[model samples]
Target: MQRSDLLYGLIDLFESFWQMAVPLSAQGEPTDDAGPDPTQETRQLLTYLSGGLTDGAIARELGVSERTVARRITRLQEVLGARTRFQLGIQATRHGWI
Candidate 1:
């Protein structure tokens, strides 16, 4: 398998273990959408973006409008504290959301 795939898988395993081991109250962090990860749709969007797909292409592939795609990206940025697409991608990967 590719290095990126292995890294992503390992990150997911570690995150799953971390969640199982820690309680939310013990972590002392405010929760949103149930955890520190994006929703499945948001993860799919990030995957398309990381694969270098444009907004229009993603829209077509997902049967959504360009506007919808843009809005989702914007929402993800706000939720993830990202100011730009590059930052969003980085943050999503760091969160194991992509």
Candidate 2:
């Protein structure tokens, strides 16, 4: 399969696992405190990164500079206590954040 197709499949699998692992409330919100509203951007960045997007691509998609993306990712890592992108992805998966 193509890379995009593979990515989509992985995303679908992750979504399914997430739904099974952490059901949403009747109001359609996650039960846990993933973080504050200001961290929404960090969550988006993590999602994009998990989907295999590069910092340059994420910067373009988010309409921000690559430097800003890097900085935000660093801050996200700090907040999540993730030592690496792989760890961030794992933490996100475990916390049902994606």
Candidate 3:
């Protein structure tokens, strides 16, 4: 399949998994804010995640310290209600925030 097809398929799979795994209201609520208006930094962070980079790699790319990267990632996790990096990716993809 094409890369686009694969990407969409993966998104679909994640959406389905979330729909089945989480309650309707619980699935919609993110811990940080109600709306999904991510900042430029957050967007860049998501782009880095899409590239499958580690926090260290992302910090290097953004010219920041790993501690800063970790802080941002922690905030992102709360904002997206994702317990892990993998779940963050899936949730971000599903919400069209990535």
Q: Write the per-residue lDDT of candidate 1 for residues 68-90, one digit (tens) a residue.
A: 99999998878766677886776
Q: Between candidates 1 and 2, which one is better according to TM-score? A: 1
Misplaced by over 4 Å in model 3 are: 1-33
Tell me the lDDT of model 2 at 67: 100
- TM-score (C-alpha, index-matched) for candidate 1: 0.62
Q: How far out, in Å, is residue 9 in model 2?
A: 42
lDDT of 2 by residue, 1-98 (tens): 44798889999999987654533354444445657654577678888999999999999999999999999888766655566788667656656667
- What would the per-residue lDDT of candidate 3 be over residues 1-98, giving only the tens digit for each residue? 44798889999999988765522345544434436578887888989988989879999999999999988888877777677787777777656677
Clashes of each: 0, 0, 0
- Give candidate 3's whole-model lDDT: 0.75
Instruction: Give the TM-scores of the predictions, in the order they appear.
Output: 0.62, 0.58, 0.62
Name the regions of candidate 2 deviating beyond 4 angstroms: 1-39
Error of 2 at 32 (Å): 12
lDDT of 2 at 4: 96
